[model samples]
Target: MKSSLTTIAKHPSISLLKSCTTMKELKQIHAQLVVKGILNHPHLQGQFVATIALHNPTNLNYANQILHHQCHHPTLFTLNSMIRAYSKSTTPHKSFHFYSKILHFNNLSPDHYTFNFLVRTCAQLHVHVTGVSVHCALIKHGFEHDPHVQTGLIFMYAELGCLNSCHGVFEGVVEPDLVSRTAMLHAYAKCGDIEFARKMFDEMPQRDFIAWNAMITGYAQCGRSRDALSMFHLMQMAGVKINEVSMVLVLTACTHLGALDQGRWAHAYVERYKLRMTVTLGTALIDMYAKCGSIDKAMEVFWGMKEKNVYTWSSAIGGLAMNGLGEESLDLFNSMKQDGVKPNEVTFISVLKGCSVVGLVEEGRKHFHSMRTLYGIDPQLEHYGLMVDMYGRAARLEEALIFINSMPIKPHVGAWSALLHACRMHKNKELGELALEKIVELEDKNDGAYVLLSNIYADYMNWEKVSSLRQTMKAKGVKKLPGCSVIEVDGEVHEFFVGDKSHPRYDEIELKLEEIFRCLRLSGYVANTSPVLFDIEEEEKEDALGKHSEKVAVAFGLITLKGVPIRVVMNLRICWDCHNVAKMISKIYDTEIIIRDRSRFHHFKKGDCSCKGYW
Candidate 1:
């Protein structure tokens, strides 16, 4: 609108931008520049575009107005600004439409920065075929060699799980920066190839925090929890400052190992440094504490969070269910719904688990049926298993059979395994055999199925069938998985097996166990030897029951650690004898003992278990 643009020629760009603290101030300055006949000045216009696109923290609509409405003939800087804004925005359609403007309205060819922004937008949208077209545009414009552009392309392809294409783009980089190489590392890890990811990681001459985080998280995704913890320690020892991201991954490792002590240390580190507790890091802490036998602490972290995403609610709710707080878990689910958090399949899975723990048959049935009707979430195999387990645990084998037959999908191995466990609990050979038959029909003949069937027969005094099942297992080369338990003490994990006597303080632990046994006998702790049901003497049966892996792990914890909670991770379900003994140990020692067995969690406090003998 100005006739001669010279009134604002004395103003410096830096000071002018420094004056804009709000969008109103910025708009006023723009109007003054235009009325003063300096708005079209190249340097001032470029600064305005940059300020609108990158600097203006309040609103981005000003950029669009300046380029589309104010300037009939906008410069290259103006187009790039608008494009960059749209690229970072969540809704990217406007960004692409603006990119099309360059070909239609503007005669200016797209520069490397322009295409770089477009590539980043494509990555954010995760539109693969469209991204490939954008890549073709970059090639057509001869900006393919641009490092930032190629890096964007690499990330887009990597996110699409297209590792082969990532390899081509990565190999083409004449000199790769840390971002590009980390993208490649993450790409390999995404495909579950830890070895190749490590090879690429080791080849890097310099690794940043992002690079190290990629390695730790890759190991976790691959189910290498021990290796992930090892890498985190190495990263710390190498003098790389750990961030919240690394802390989350390490906490996840602790969750896998049931390493309560290590998880506590990570929590302390977060507090000591006053690092920002992002949603991800907070969710990880909740999960870690919950799995580590500290459900109260998990709840503490959960309630303290100002923001709760689906992951946060799901982990906290699921933790309660797994720890045998069925009623509390259900209540929290209701709260999550009232908070407007949509219940996904994972959330329903936790809800179903809570229903199973509390024997809420009618509630479970209603929710399972409503999964597709109300939530549009089709019931997966795990849901079927939960229903079956619920019925079976409630001593309703007939309903379990009916549910399995009604499943839209096939009742896979997990579902049948749940039914088998229920039959074992009720000592029902008829239904146990039926479930075992279905289990054998599946592709993976879970050895646990054979063992469960055998245990069921042993409980019913059908020794002949038990012997026959074990013979068949040997003929098929199926072996029962050895039961093992691990306990963490002072940042070190000690593993114990059934009848383990290999600890360095074996004599001392044995002596302590004897003393505890004497005290247990005085307190009328009658060992129920029904689980060791073999053609053995009473003495041998009692001995076998006493030497269970869970008991050994607890004894080790009591011997080494003092006055703190004892947490143990077991590879097999705790037998009834060990469960009873654990309750007595809790009451006798005046200490809490938490055990995570193959099935679910048992938090024993003052002779009372969280499961309440339901599991």
Candidate 2:
């Protein structure tokens, strides 16, 4: 029977004989081939090899063993199948080495699919040199013109941050396809060139869902939030069906722009499309509400979700921290731990911020230590800055300085600024000067640092140093960022600058502010004009403080909104005098005022800020 099987397997019709559609039929044929002992024959062996490799049958390892012992040298198709299997397998490198063996020993010419498998492995491993070597091999063998090969090459070069190389490869192809164009767009976006990405996207003649998603994600990631939303609108107008990823990007852009109306539209679109339940989309929704100053809405979205992950928890935690529900945020952190979801670095940062806001020094210290001992996550620079800010605000200047020295990474301007502010708070002029020196060394153009340092020197009557610092700033062309604040009243965002009269209603705002001051004075609010220049007359100092950006914002809130609490969001820290006035305004008007300053939310009601006057 074995001799007869060998003869029939070599009969040349064996390739046609083994072409069975179903695995059951294939196995029956295999049984017949075994009865005749033709499975070991070379010509018949290739048939078994091609069939099993492509069929995805059970007992594939056994089939592989049979082919390995029989052929000693496999055919091109046989090698290609094995290559693909290995490419899809966990051990791609081993499959790649096998293909090399096929090429070296039997001179088996690899096809398009073979190189595809090999290059994909290089991409997965992020082995740029290996990928380039494979590209050279393809060029040497004259297969570079294959579109599939070009696509793979584009992806490899892009991932390597070699956008120029990716463009070079794409240009070599005559009329590149959608996949290659999308790859170039992704390359540009990943390399932080959003303009070039948009150009590449525009040049493409045709686009699929993947291409659109790539471009949208690129825009979203490159801080082109408005552009991303505009593109989404255009895609919708073009009748392109929105996918989960597209929704995610646009929702994130809404979050960044603080576009509450657009965010609501996105939320409605998600419900309309029945995508509200998707984890990615749900997380984006939560983030959108949180960032749009609607923490209650964010919580609603969070609680509505049936599934949640670290990002979901982080978004809610960070949102609550931002909204000044510090106690609630900390409670959620505890709940997250109780649910067995390990806190990541970002989660810890949010909770730390909550601690900083509420002055939970002991809890903050415990979490800081637990970062490494419990979670095994080392604190990064931002975390360090937060800790320094925390300790500094708690009036632990020495401990703050000690922590600065103990940081694993060199202190950046942000960390130094934290300590500098702490020094000013505690009147540590010497340490403030030292921190300023480090800050200038790290970031010479830091206007805030210069201003803070100058103020510290002035506090101690170091007029000469202040003059020198001012002259240096003028020489270096370092312009200070003008203080600004935004107050939303009656569905309009009113922006104000320190001592600015740019608004068309500037006169009305001024008159109303004067009235507010008179009312405050009548209610026992005294102006602390020390933060303003003493060189100015006493009345002028009062006038300047009244025209400070935050004061204008609060004044507008009081005059424009009727019978409601006002929320004022400022981009800078509230000065001591301004904070005092806010407390007084809230008390006299009998209205709540929520001020989100540079650091945290200060909810003022009846002559009290959430910080307890410590910040």
Candidate 3:
């Protein structure tokens, strides 16, 4: 039997292990090694563990069982293989158990490879303390200077939100290579230090797709969408390889700016280059289109996707809700469940928002309750807020208050803000004041709540209260956010603030707006000045209403984009006066106007709105 084992070890079944395509073949070889009495051979044992650990469809459980129970003594190579595999696995925290085992074995010591995988595992775990301990181990082992290990440290620190530590690790490198530098770039970008990221990116003698992606994603996430798009264009001009990450980041930028023309160009570029439409890219496209007020195009993308995940379904459902197609959103949510995609927390938020948008009060209640009871998802603050908004939008103010009072957790400012909005809409000064009180207790600088309550007072002709509210806002140093609108024309995004005249062609836009309102008046359109919070002269109030950001953007769109739908994205809700004007303009000019505000989309066509005047 010893002679037979020697012969098998000399010949070795390592080749067979390497060629394994499935777990069954691997198990057969493992059993053969056992029968041949060479399974405990150090070299053969390492090979067997590696094969199982690095299999195409890895069987970590089998490898783990063999390491813990079957193999009486495992080599450092065998344990490192297991650690590397577990580091990349879903249960990365399990890698620590193997690291503990490595520490116990005085005969074996961790190498740079071990530290690399262990640092990555710490990153995956997102446990800062564990990551610091691994860093210390790497330093103690004198492998901290390894470029790969340093890169891993950078990533781990970045993931743990220890940006200063990331910088320290990066600075420790004598002459960082491109990989290490790129890792540092990613660290800075991930930590929201885009300035440092860009500096690193520009200083690099050579830049790869990963570096470019980190920079672009940083810009997109930091609300610098214009800069993100600009970086993408520069990336193309620099002749860099564009991949799925590039497309997704650019789509996010387009979504933020409501740059549909550019977004459409991105979609065309994806098809023109034949880049595989991954689920993430597909979801980003849906989000961009839906947010840019092209819901039909969003639905088209949704239907064309061959694969759908929970996020994809949620994006589509939320898109429908944003476009004010509430019933369709609910139907799609049901279909998502039917397709076996369990709804996550975000899915329920979209579902509830859909209910609130269309005033599906009972349906919203059912879904909200189902979150905790049926799906085991605890009702988060956003869900509770959506329920309050739904009831409030339906004019069930008493029920909304009751629901807020009955929350299992402390009521957030969102719930109170929703009730305050409903009070402003219904001109309920008493409840609006009550909601304002609650909101002030939570967030003293909640400008929206104060604005809504002030509007309510104005609606009731309580000019003295409105003045007092304004004085209070001043005393509290709370200023209302200026309304801003973005419009895309000829692939360039133009922004407008309330009463802005910053555009070079502001004169032309103003002239065009004058012509539009002239035609609108002829068509019996009168400015509804009730939304003006300040008690000013009626004529001055009308003037203020006309200079709203959306009107300026729409006027510019009409000037530049003839015969195309004028899509406007705003930072605030559309006032009743603006909604009426948009409807009249759609009829008078025979045009389609789509306005996406902070709340929902208003699709105005032929003297009607898709919202049916519900919002």
Judged by lDDT, which candidate is best? Answer: 3
Cα lDDT, model 1, residue 494: 80
Model 2 lowest lDDT segment of ten: 54-63
Q: Taking the candidates one at a time, how many backbone clashes does each contain?
A: 1, 0, 0
Q: Global lDDT for candidate 2? A: 0.79
Among all candidates shown, the one with the greatest TM-score: 3
Instruction: Report the lDDT tens digits of candidate 1 across residue range 1-615.
Output: 253334343475436776677777777787777786667776577668777777743356777777766676666677777778877775665777677777766467788988888877887887789888988988998998988887877887877778888899999999988899998999899877889999999999899999999999899988788799899999999999888999999999999889998999999999999888999999999999998888999999999999998899999989998988888998999999999888889999999998899899998898888889988988889989999999998889898989899888978998888989999888888988988998998944478888778788777767788778867877788866778888999998788887768888778777877887888999998877766635578788887887888888898899878998999999888888899999999999999999999778998999999888867
lDDT order of candidates, top first? 3, 1, 2
lDDT of 3 at 238: 91
- Per-candidate TM-scores read 0.77, 0.72, 0.89
User: What is the total number of backbone clashes in candidate 2?
Assistant: 0
| lDDT for each residue of candidate 3 in 202-320, tens digit (9 for 90 to 100) | 99989889888988988888899999999999999999999988999999999989899999999999999999899999999999999888899999999999999989999999999
For model 2, residues 1-615, the per-residue Cα lDDT tens digits are 787667675654455445556666666767777777666565566667666765553435645776667567666667777766665554556567657766887566777877877777666667778778888888887888999888888887877778888888998989777777888889899888988888888888988778888888888888677678888888998888788888888889876655566778888887888864688888999998876667899999998888888899988998898777778899999988988788999998899988877778889999999999998899999899989988988888889889999988998888899999988777888889899889989988888787777777767777677778888888887877777777655434467888788888888888988888888889887876655533567788788888889888888878887777676666678877799999988888888877767776677889898778755
Give the Cα error of residue 377 in candidate 2, in Å: 2.7
How accurate locally, in lDDT, is each candidate?
Answer: 0.85, 0.79, 0.89
- Could you give me the TM-score of model 2 versus the true structure? 0.72
Candidate 1, poorest ten consecutive residues by summed lDDT: 1-10
Q: Tell me how far the alpha carbon of residue 202 in candidate 1 is from the true structure, in angstroms, after superposition.
A: 3.7
